[model samples]
Target: MRAVVYDAPGAFSVREVPVPEPGPGEVRLAVEMAGMCGTDVHIDAGGFFSRYPLTPGHEIVGRVDALGDGVTSLARGEPVVADNTVLCGHCAPCRRGEPLFCANFYSLGVNGPGGFADCVVVRAEKCFAAGDLDLGTAVMAEPTACVVHGLDVLDLRPGADVLVFGAGPTGLVLAQLLAHGGAARVTVAAPTARKLDLARSYGTDVTVEIDRSDPARALPVLRAAAPDGYDVVVDATGAASVVEICLGLVRDGGTFFVYGMADEQLSVPLHPYEVFRRELTIKGSFAQTHCFERSLALLRSGRVRTDGLVTHEFALGDYGLALEATRSDRSCVKAAVVP
Candidate 1:
């Protein structure tokens, strides 16, 4: 089997590796497609600590090639996607139904071998069937699960106005979910006009191009577009500065959601006075858990546009090229590797 191995930070190589077999309660998948994510870039750049010589790809989808003992719900040749979070069911958080916060929670691609290979093994319990969807879209199950987490945490009412920061894949997907959830108005702010255009195509009601030098300028523009400040503001940029700006843009008593992973320590001016006066609620959403199945259902139902999100594709052997393209291609939304 050919696999892309992360030798170390800023280093990766494609090499022929021995094929892996499924262990008990596990299933081996012949990977059809794997999505290259921002986290992959971070891992490559040493932004996140990863085991050296790792296989780094989590947004994966494939057909079951073999199943180990005790795996009965899935059959060979079944198309599926697996939940990224690898949790210990006996952990305190898992016992409380919050596996995302499990004390022993780890993830594929980060803490274990992932799908940047010809075949990958996953727990049968984590796999969800992706009925009748193309491999390209099926690979989006992981990201969509993250979006589902954000949406679930927000709990916004229908017709609520939304302001989303960043027009990257996640932001665009979030916009679509907000629209599907009946948001009356959704504004997407991004520094890139191309991504803003893409967000609009995905149903963002308004798009604002923020000049990098004047990011704060977008706030007033967004407020004017929404008129009542935004009912809900989501910061997906993962930049501390942007998160600080979002705190001021949400309306009184409205909610602010932070769904991005910051690379550095974040320092923001506190507004305890305003927080007390407005009764605003600010929250953060992390990795997916218990949402992977719903995300697959969304794809199976053909409700949200996932195919268009794949702007680039590469062969498994061209892993380096794929990572380079993801880092440099401003117009690319999501890139996938097919094995």
Candidate 2:
């Protein structure tokens, strides 16, 4: 077997490794397609909850190759999507019915051996039969699940006017979800024109192309789009500068949602007096909890489209190149590693 092993932060290599066998209640997957995410780059730099000696590819779509003892729900050769999140039921947060805040969280690819290999072991219960979904589309289940979680946090009021910043894969998904999830009008802002075009095709009401390096330059244009300000403002770009500037776009008593993965060290200034006077709600959404089933359903129903979402694919040996392109290449919408 072969895998991309990260010995530590800023260090990794594609090397031959022994194939792992599944334990009780687990199954081994023959990796078919593993989606590369911005979080992977974060993990590579020792950010997030990354654990050393990790095989870090979380968005996985594969076929069940072997089943462990007591795993009778699925059969060998079944196509499926694996949920990467693993939580300890005894954690304080879990006991409080908030598994998202579990004290001991172990996400495959972030803090455990993941799908960046030819074959990887995962809990059988986490594997959802993809049914008739295309492999490329199925790879989006993880991210869509995260978007689902973001929507859960936002809880937009009916007919609310919403604005989303960013047109990358997750950003596009978030915009589409907002468009259908109760927002009367959904507007998307990004640096790329083509991505905005894509957003329009996905039911976005309006699209604005802002200079990524100078987001403030488009402030006048954005204000003209909705002079009263948006009922809900979301920053999906994960850029601290963008977040700081867009926070002002939220209407009075409106909500501001942070859906992007920004740097841990980054900080943005907020006016305490304004928040107090406006009665604003500021919320942040992290990785999902028990949302994969809905994510897969949305994808399967074509409500959340995946066409043209996956713009690039790479060989397992070229994982580093894929990661670099994902981080720096604005032209690359989504990158997948075909193991």
Tell me, by lDDT, which candidate is best: 2
CA deviation > 4 Å runs, candidate 2 = none
Clashing residue pairs, backbone N/CA/C < 3 A, model 2: none
Off by over 4 Å in 1: none
- Residue by residue across 1-339, what tens digits does model 1's lDDT show? 999887778878889989899999999999899999888888887666577778989898888999999999999999888776788899888998887788886788876889999999999998888857787688888998999988898887998988888877788888889989989988888888878877877678888899765688776677678666788999888876688788788889888888877774557787999888988898888878889878877777777677567888999988888898887787777888998
**Per-residue alpha-carbon lDDT of model 2 for 112-186, expressed as tens digits?**
999889988999999999959998899999999999999998998989999999999999999988887988999
What local distance difference test score does each model get? 0.84, 0.91
Work out the TM-score per prediction.
Answer: 0.94, 0.98
**Which residue window of length 10 is worst by lDDT in model 1?**
261-270
On TM-score, the candidate that comes out on top is: 2
